[model samples]
Target: MANLDLTLKDMMAVDGAVGAAVVDYDSGMALGHLGGSKALDLQVAAAGNTEVVRAKIRTMEQLRIKEDIEDILISLSTQYHVIRPVSGRKGKGLFLYLALDRGRANLALARHRLRDIEENIEV
Candidate 1:
């Protein structure tokens, strides 16, 4: 596992990857970001998405699901937003957010790739 710079490059290599960011949910700050478009700001997306993760976690707590979130996928006509919260004590309150071109990506493979990235990524 390397650092943010190396991992971000790996993420961008995923098929159809548009952008990727390592974000700290607790602070709404991006540890690093790459490939964001003018129409899609990774920093803004990271901050706003932290709330989405928080709310989901809160809801799960209230519901007593006792399960962890592996990843979240939000799809639109032209794009996909994937939010993956980092697990383990070392990864708590941090996440990787990725954007993809809807027509170009395979969701299942992308999810698997993201998992691999998460597992090997270094802070």
Candidate 2:
């Protein structure tokens, strides 16, 4: 199994991956991050996205929808933003954020790869 740091490193190696971070939605903080540029700061992105996550969860709660978030995909002209919430008791309220170059990334493959990365990444 890949450890957190190692798995994050592996994710950064994906063809289009530009930046990645493991974030805690409850706290709006990134526990770990890698490969960010001036235009995209992983920590800042993580913090901002935490609100998105929280808002979604709250909305679901209010709607009485009993479900888990698999992942949230935000597509931009130049990039693909992926938010994958970790499962299992040990990983509650945490997610993996990956930003990839749209031209270089294969969305399906990247989603599948992120699932694998999630399985192997230890808290």
- Backbone clash count, each prediction separately: 0, 0
Residue-level lDDT of model 2, residues 38-90, one tens digit each, is: 99999899999998898888999999999988899999999999999988666
Residue-wise C-alpha lDDT for candidate 1, range 1-123, written one tens digit per residue? 758898899889989999999999999999999998899999899999999999999999999999989999999899999999988666788999999999999889999999998888778
What are the runs in model 1 whose C-alpha is more than 4 Å off?
none
| RMSD to native, candidate 2 | 1.0
lDDT, candidate 1, at 99: 96
| Strongest candidate by lDDT | 1
Q: How much does candidate 1 score in TM-score? A: 0.96
After best superposition, candidate 1 residue 123: deviation in angstroms? Answer: 0.5
Candidate 2 off by > 4 Å:
none
lDDT of each: 0.91, 0.90
